[model samples]
Target: MKKKLGMFAGLVLFVVLMAACAADSSQEESDSGDSNSSGSEDSSAENQDTTEISFIHWRGEDEEVFDDIIGQFEEENPGISVQMNTYPSEQYQSNAQQMLRDGSTGDVFTSFPGTQFETINNAGFFTDLSDEEFVNNFAETSLEVGQSEGSQLAVPYQMVFNMPVYNKGMFEELGIEVPTSWSEYQAMAETLKENDITPIAFPGADIGPNQMMNSMMMNNAKNEDIFAQLESGEETLTNDWWINTLEDFQHFNENGYLQEDALGTNQDSAMQMVADEEAAMLATGSYHMASLKELNSDLELGFLPPITVSEEEVEYEGIHTATFMLAVNKNSEKKEEAKAFIEFLSQPDIASQYANETGQHLTVNDVDYESESLQNTSHWIDEKDTRFQPRYLIKEAAVEDAVLGSIENVLGGTSPEEAADEAQQVVEENID
Candidate 1:
């Protein structure tokens, strides 16, 4: 009887011990699973914390410089990433509105000074950046270009002289001086032609003629705000000032001062002609200086506005435009991130880096320019009598197009008078 009772006790103890061991093993397995699950959750949370923003602009040429800046921005901001989107200037000018309307492509975007800015602002596509701290970093003149009414809508990033870029070495070699009067300019062109050099590589295909018109009519117009006058119906495209500008184009064409097939020549080809020393000047802006230098690093360059008026009548020496206005999309999901990226760019050191790398004249104050091209032309920013580009002051695209198209029409064999009349009709149709 004792032996049977002892055997039952032993069996019960064995069963209890087995249950305890099983529970310990189960708890060990559960802890291991929990540890892996917690690690995965942490990794997923880290991924969710990162924000990506899109920066859209028309400066395909500045892609490399911008990429470098973006890389620095990402390093400084570990939680954010930037995706850059660039388009050709013409395509961006035409399609930027449609792309921005959806709010998917451009978390941050750029617009031109007058009509495009007004159109985009009126549509409420821009965030009011009036209160942003970064807004204080830019000059008031630069800021004004981006403002609509009282609200600070955008920030102009580049201050560029929209005048012709000439080959300094070529001019020196030919014993020619910068002209201060229309007659002198004509003589200079004749000399260049005499030397078997194209005087002006005019790219009439896209924005070339429109850009050149800024310098061509700077002093010829009686009023500085002639384009504004046209918009207000106080003047017409058929005004003498407008006709004279077209006639200048005709004179250049007739004199063989422009490149062969000028109307068909694009900006790139025009730039190359000057770079290769085949042409003495490119009827474009200082914004293209870096590009021209890229084609020929040894090329010495300078700005030369067409001096259309007598030296005594010259009111402005060159044209300056505050363009590529940067704005945050009003509907962006990552507004904070987008604004942060802009703020990063607005910093003086960063802006300097960008300016030097891209050879752009930045709107940011006190940025040190290291590029030879920028240093050579930096004096024009303050020392010269530069006027805001009248071409940008036109607020209606149709009217602006008609005005610019008149120059193209004259280049394509139409008389200046006929082109002026045609442009006036289009302007009246659009405005009236």
Candidate 2:
């Protein structure tokens, strides 16, 4: 089975964590402030002393915890209130677009801000917070994700990465160490199959799950240059590196190693494969760790960089970023209070609490990570940061999305070259 991210992923299995924590005060008072102003123009404009902050996020079991945290913030700072607006996960992006454009929705909100970030930032919806003091506190990569044209447009709150997770116990029983090279990876898969186990699990049914496959290809193939090359109209996706990675993925699919019904499996079912020990390996991010613990806190998880065949000996850091970040509306009347909340959230105490409560890794330097995998990942990120290669870095979100779409095509029977070509065309036609 495939894994999911965040707190609900774990707590969902037990079914009773919800009932026991229902009466928590801080959790319940956090309001969903979507109520719009009254119509017909008030007979007299009233003076409002309280500053209200609104945000839109995905619905989950952890919302109560979030509200509880916000409630504490409101208590410490009177005359301000947080209006946490939430939407079903399916409608979150679209609704956020409407609200952002509506001018009266959230004064603050969560966004991936990869491709669409430039569009939103350029339209003058988010404030330029480059000079803000909190900017210095964020990891450089987190801040970079939210930067637009030399100015900071958002604050990254969570960190995520896509890599391999292995069942250490299963590997130990097989007397195998985690493979570090492409050759070793193939051998491990073969050995697992010989032992009558699925070597790995993949979910190609939805775009989100399918995206992991694509991201791995991009990372391993070092097609980081492909985005700009195609955008400039000087090249096409028929490049060798792209072709090589697609063929590699094709070989893996044909080998009878991936989960059965792979093309039809969803993330939930795919995650279960790993937990059930039907498969020994799964590809996912650190966020899945919290969920994995819920199923079996004893299940051992490890990460491996996507395999590569590049001649340049590319660095093998996995793809990751501070999770979706919080940005203040530059046009909002409550900028001061919103900024204060931003500072409050970044405090070591608050970040640590969020990490513990949600099981999501944050990018702040203030907190000490308790998880071994997280500590190792942080070290790997530091190494990659120093090398600074453009190839797998995915500097722009637009490029990342385009790459993901192309990967989907390759996974769905289109050749990697063809997928790259289509992606290049899209870049030329859409990106400026």
Q: Which numbered prediction scores highest in lDDT against the true structure?
A: 1
Clashes of each: 0, 12
True-vs-predicted CA distance for residue 261, candidate 1, Å: 2.2
CA RMSD for every model?
13.5, 13.5
**Weakest 10 consecutive residues, lDDT, candidate 2?**
38-47
| Candidate 2 residue-wise lDDT, 1-432, digit = tens | 345454667767556666546634323332222222332224113314445677667646568878888998988987677878788755775556667774445677776644445556666788777888987777876677787667788888887665556787899899987665677778888999998888877766652443355345644555455556755655555676656766676666678667765677776776788888888767565667667667776677765545554424545555665546688776566677788888888888887787777766687767767665555555655565222223234435565567666766755677767777877676666656
TM-scores of the candidates are 0.87, 0.79
Instruction: Give model 1's clash tally.
Output: 0
Runs of candidate 1 with Cα error greater than 4 angstroms are: 1-45
Encode model 1's per-residue lDDT on 370-401: one tens digit a residue.
98889999888779989889988888889988
C-alpha-based local distance difference test score of model 2: 0.65
